[model samples]
Target: MRRAAQGMLATIALALLTAPSSLARVYLTQDQALALAFPAPASVQRRTLYLDAAQAARAGREAGGAVETRVVPYYVGTAEGRPVGYAYFDTHLVRTLPETIMVLLAADGRIRRIDILSFDEPEDYKPTERWLQQFPGRGPGDELSLNGGIHALTGATLSARAVTQAARRVVALHRLFVAPFPPPSGPAPGKGDGAPPGAPGAVRP
Candidate 1:
């Protein structure tokens, strides 16, 4: 009887291993993400933002994380020495595993695009690319929580929440770090550029 039980468990494990989304990679690399976000990027700089305990707590609250992850990576791009935009990824729990979402933010902090890196959830529960269209042009000021601002997925509540939270997380993190750093004071040398871009956000299309 014990042998039979062990065989059953092994069969279960084998079945799970053969499952479609089980441990299968479905997302682009970080380098690939950056490349897609910027085809002809003049420069792509990797930046890290570390938050103090208090700020960490706040970030968690904003991201709906039970305990905040303190270190975050943000990528900034430039074209011909002019600011292009910012790119970042946020990982949040959905179902059992975590999903990484790559977000491309315009220079003004509005969401330019959202790329689902890997969603380890059930096939039926996967959010469609069309569904992601709802988030473009949204930014830190908007509440991305489902039903409040963004619409909710009928069946995939957790995935919807997880992604929405992740979006909010990165935008909030951007606001906390990048927004504070004042850009070149007054008018830039040759360009009419003056001051860093503001986060008034984008108009929904």
Candidate 2:
């Protein structure tokens, strides 16, 4: 009986040692991601934009997905007192677990980079850096979907879809609320025909 008990304990220990871990893997923090996105000579500013119901609806329509929050936080990079780029951090579920990603955009509202900050799913399900490289330069108008413009990820379809959706949503938000406004052209100063470049009634281009 004693021998049998000892063997059972050994088997249990072996199984525990070989079992897969379920903890979330953290690759980078938000500050680290910001540093990587905007290197030296580029200063980063944190900004928050509140979206009204109408604005949120339009963004959802453009992105083909729901806007998860009305209050959004983003970062802007500037150099030589001129705009450089934008960055947004999105955390969403990939399958039953949560994953956080930082989406970086160029000054023209195109995708520049994507970095996974933390992932709760198995490492195998995370998209590779090679796969993520395809996203750079994609704009809000691009078809950023699975098998549309982005190639499918074998055995990691859910993760791929989640990341794609997040990317689309961030770009849409930038285009709608954060892109630089064009110069006022509809009316002269004090004409009362349209708002000034970035005034209340100004048209966003």
Best-matching candidate per lDDT? 2
Q: How accurate is candidate 1 locally (lDDT)?
A: 0.72
- Backbone clash pairs for candidate 2 read none
lDDT of 2 by residue, 85-167 (tens): 99999999999888999999999989999999998888999998999998999996688998999998899999999999999
In candidate 1, residue 75 scores what lDDT? 83
The superposed Cα distance between candidate 1 and the true structure at residue 11, in angstroms, equals 7.6
Cα deviation of 73, candidate 2, in Å:
0.2
Q: What are the RMSDs of all candidates, in order?
A: 8.1, 7.4
Model 2, global lDDT? 0.83
Error of 1 at 42 (Å): 3.1
What is the lDDT for 183 in model 2?
A: 24
Worst 10 residues of 2 by lDDT: 182-191
